[model samples]
Target: MSAMVDTPAAQPLPRRTEGSSARIGALAPLSSPGWVEAGRHLLAGLESGVLDVNDAGGVLGRPLELVVRDTAADPQRAAAAVEELAGLGVAAVAGEYHSVVARAAAAKADALGLPFLCSSAVLDALTDRPTDWVARLAPAQSHGWRIYAEFLLGAGHRRIAVAAQPSVYWESGTRILREHLAPRCGTVIELDMGALTPEDVCDALADHGATALLLLTGIPEPAVSLVRSVRADRRLAGVLVGAPAGQPEFGPWAALLGEDGAGIPFLRYLPERLGPLGARVGSALRERLGRAPSFVAFEGYDTITVLADVLSAGELSRERIPASWAGVAVEGTRGPIRFSRVPGVGVRQWAWAPVQVVDRDPAALDRFRVLRTG
Candidate 1:
């Protein structure tokens, strides 16, 4: 972990007249195949924070409510959701997972002059533009890829092969890995997994003498197939396999991949070890939802906490929210959360967010272990 930097605190702004409710909009893929459970976790965090605030006399002495909109993992639907949320008079908007949907929502939120706090979208390009109203809770793809590169180098993997799906999220991460790891490694082979079969991937790994394979696809079918193919081939048995941040959550990947999912490392927001605050939040979530909190839940809870802090300390209106966030810092489940305006990346991004490499224990697939942190 890095030392926390001190940033200026938000200045108090004039309070608005008392209202019955302070509503914030939440957008998530509640209908998408792999994202429905993630959306539930996000909602759990948002609702938990809202309930806590209401118990503590709420923001501006009014109850805070969440207006959730399902994006269906579609860009067009996400943009439309932004319009609906804004028309409903939400003070700000938060929550999203898919990068495509988040990018569309961020643009719409900017057009509507609403503060949009991205929860888990990690594509670098989402925040690679000049949008003051947009801020991300998740670490950018570059941050995670840097950690992946270091892990590979530390493991003495000189010849690295990357298998990726041709999505915006995977493309951004692949580019980062190529730029950072190419010079360090003996050779870097990039393959489009969408056009290749499992046998084709195995053949490339063997042909290139790859010591490590990085799978950058978020979809489970390809990831599972590739892992199975890698495991089945004794010739490639020495090759270490991993994913970026695309593996499925809450044990589905484990169940689907069976023994194949074991020992496959990937970058994730939450570590296997929880801090005091993380443990408390996890306990609360489990008790309320009857399941452990997922990484997305932690992000959702933290996003609302940051928003509430800004809204309570500064002006309650949307106009001052961006300025309020400029200097604000709050403790989240992961660590201290703050925003920065990177030159080329998105403006107001939570640049210092933590990421870790996690893998399922081969003997116990249900157990996940944190291998490295950054």
Candidate 2:
């Protein structure tokens, strides 16, 4: 049975009766067209967090419940989930891995006055305007991708090529790379995945003298195919393949590509050393996952931790949840969790989670090597 089967496709999202369990809505992509591996890790962390909270006597003397809804990587579906969850009387909403989907949920949550602590989405513009309704645990795309750009530059990759598909998230990432790199004498080359085949990408890389090729496309399809093509081509042997979206952080990427997936630096939000709390959580997550947990899992765990703290701080009412964003000071798995207004960001943002550019070590394919940190 797949992970999707373990978690039902849809669960009833009806309002909880008064004096019953306090509910929080969870959004994740747990089925096809979504990153199932990521969703499973995220949900595992969330469920674990809930279990720990309940073990500690629950939130505000009531069992804290998660009303999970599969976003399935759909923006429209995510928006509707936010509306339904709001009507279901969930105190707030949490968890979404995709940025575009989270953006939709954030907009809807803001409109409906629901506090949403976005777990994994890193899009800088999470909302249309500055609002107090949403906060994010992941570092913004600009911040993390800039670190990636610096990593590329430090490694002597000035001429970079990105094989990208059309996405608000991917497009935003491309633009950020362009703006950040142009002044620094780094040129970004765009190879549209829609127009180019894997073979054509290799040919273009050689023709353009591009030293690095970034996979801004989706997983397992063009991304896997492109890496294979680039790796096998003798003409482009020196060309480095990269996936800056952290696609390589999950198990499937390594399982599918084997050693071919190694050396593909991507962004991950984890500290160099897991502190005591993070180490414990990481161990628990690894046991629960039956494998190493991705950073998304930690994000999910921290989301519930922050929410539990806010709900326990005093006012447990829905209206006061957004007001609690500023005063949060919980120790998260990544580090201290706090929210503040970041310029150019419309949501109260955890200014950053630890950003690292890491790759699967080529010699020891199971281990990740930290290439750079920011």
Candidate 3:
């Protein structure tokens, strides 16, 4: 349980090889403050049988055994974790929560002929590379931006700008926004976070003639800055700022924004059903993280759900897996997830990405006063 443990002995999963059992691994980052809490909810689901592999006693001859590894937010460590899962005879691994880690672990999965289904990672480089041994249940970064772009167009904003730091997410934000805007918009700009002030932001806004902004940053600190700057100048007070992360805190900033941030919108993709199992996992997430985790946990939770159905169909054999996994739709928290096989990748399904308008109440200051439940 310590941070510095070596590649320990192959401690077999409890019910494995005893009869019929499939091995599934969750490659998680206990180090990430946001995602690790999500992992805990997923763990609770796995432990409680909310994600039942038995599938009403008709899917497979075996139940699933979940193995877990802490990537600790290190990419090399993530790769090593995949190798360990391969050695443990795990049939598949959930690549870590970031694209770099997913890409690293994917190489091992491809070489060893194991399936690596992505959960939370959203780097575009992930899908750009063609591989059969890897596929993701979650949307690629491009998909995320695509959803955000559609949201913008629907809201009638043509000029777009991104406020961001130069991290991996920012790099992805630049690429996705460029692709989404180039074909359809008249003006697009990206403001770097190297250092910024109200005047600098206003100057950028003026250059683009922006009526709306797409805040690439997850939090609205940059959006707040924009509001303060625009308000002081009085000319730009009504400009809109929207967030894709759907964070609630953007609510209070609306007051500073006048009308810009209050009714301002956000985006998310979610499951369509409650099934027999969802609440169990959702509650576990709340217990562990003190709040509901995001689509990331749903991705991890759904990975198990699909595998459970597949394993419940027959004995744990590679040949039997294809029939079980192919094109099967999982009614997960993120709606329906299906899989397709690429030449080098094992089996992966294209995900349906959706965008919705989240109403934030400034009176409540970003708390979920009422969830529209799209």
Candidate 4:
């Protein structure tokens, strides 16, 4: 079950409905071409205890139910899904994947005064939203880049090399780099690999070498192309360090990079640190889906955990939820997660999990240890 949608999709504008209830909905590309696998994982997580819905803070005395609808990755369809959920009288929504879709969905959720928890959308667009009802669980990619820059600069490396895939995430990373490096008294050379072919990406990597390299982009295909190509370069053999893509999609690349990727830092919440309950979640997902869970599973899990915590505090209302979320923090598979009221986006801090490449399992890692590498 790959998590992808139909080819040549379009916008899905969603509308709100009157009245609100305790029902919570998950809007995503469940029926999309490759999404069945991820959708099943999400469903499995919800069915088991991973994304278990709290009984409206356990105050309502009735177990909460999660209603999911497939957006097919179409923006208009995504809007329709939210309209339907809003019509269902849902109090909140927990969704997975894509910052673009999340932005549309979050807009709908906010109009209805329903709480929106973004499990996978990392685009600053999603986080930069000003809605009080919206909160992003993932740390800002900029924060991760800033952390990476600090570490690389402090190591006494004057010139730095960076590679990006021209994604919005990569663009934001580049922006952060310029801002951070410009002010930090450090110099850097960024390798813009956007629109570059696999061979071109590799050549770019081989061409540049000064300090640590920051490969910014989560697109697994091209990232794999470049990582393998550059690691093979004999001249650049002993490059100091590299930061994995900020998003977990780079898990596959981690395995490809092997030893050099050993000290590669990424943002993730390892299953081990999630404790007894988190492991149970991993087992539950594997049992149902028959494949190990990754960031996708953890994302859904974190969203529910956070919403449940907020609900448990008191009645989940528009104003109250954000108020409580102001100082709230939850340890998720990604890292210590929290959000602050950033004028545009409701909450601002994204967590980082510095994982070292142990062996073949870039997908599976040593414990998610938080080190100040970025």
Model 3: ten consecutive residues of lowest lDDT: 1-10
Say which candidate scores most in lDDT: 2
Q: For model 4, how does the per-residue alpha-carbon lDDT over 147-243 read when each residue is reduced to its tens digit?
A: 6667656666556667776556567666777788876666666666665665664455456646556666543545555556666766666565455
Look at candidate 2 and tell me the lDDT of residue 282. 93
User: What are the lDDT figures for the candidates, one per model?
Assistant: 0.79, 0.89, 0.59, 0.57
TM-scores of all candidate predictions against the true structure? 0.90, 0.95, 0.72, 0.70
Q: Which ranges of candidate 3 are over 4 A from the true structure?
A: 1-16, 19-21, 33-51, 54-63, 167-169, 195-199, 206-208, 218-236, 245-264, 271-290, 318-324, 341-347, 353-359, 365-374
User: Which candidate's TM-score is highest?
Assistant: 2
Clashing pairs in 1: 127-346, 128-346
Query: For candidate 2, lDDT tens digit of each residue in 198-296?
Result: 999999999999999999998888899999999999999899899999999998998999999999999999999999999999999999999999999
Better model by TM-score: candidate 3 vs candidate 4: 3
TM-score of 3: 0.72
* Clash totals in order: 2, 0, 20, 27
Error of 2 at 105 (Å): 0.5
Local accuracy of candidate 3 as per-residue lDDT tens digits, 1-374: 11112212222333444455566777876665324544454455444343344554523545566788887667788878888887787866764665666777876665555667676666656633455456666556666666667666766777877666667766766777678867885456777756766578777877677887656553346656655566566555556666664543322344455444555566545543444556666676556546565545556667777666555553554334545556466676545667654332233545453434464555653443322333
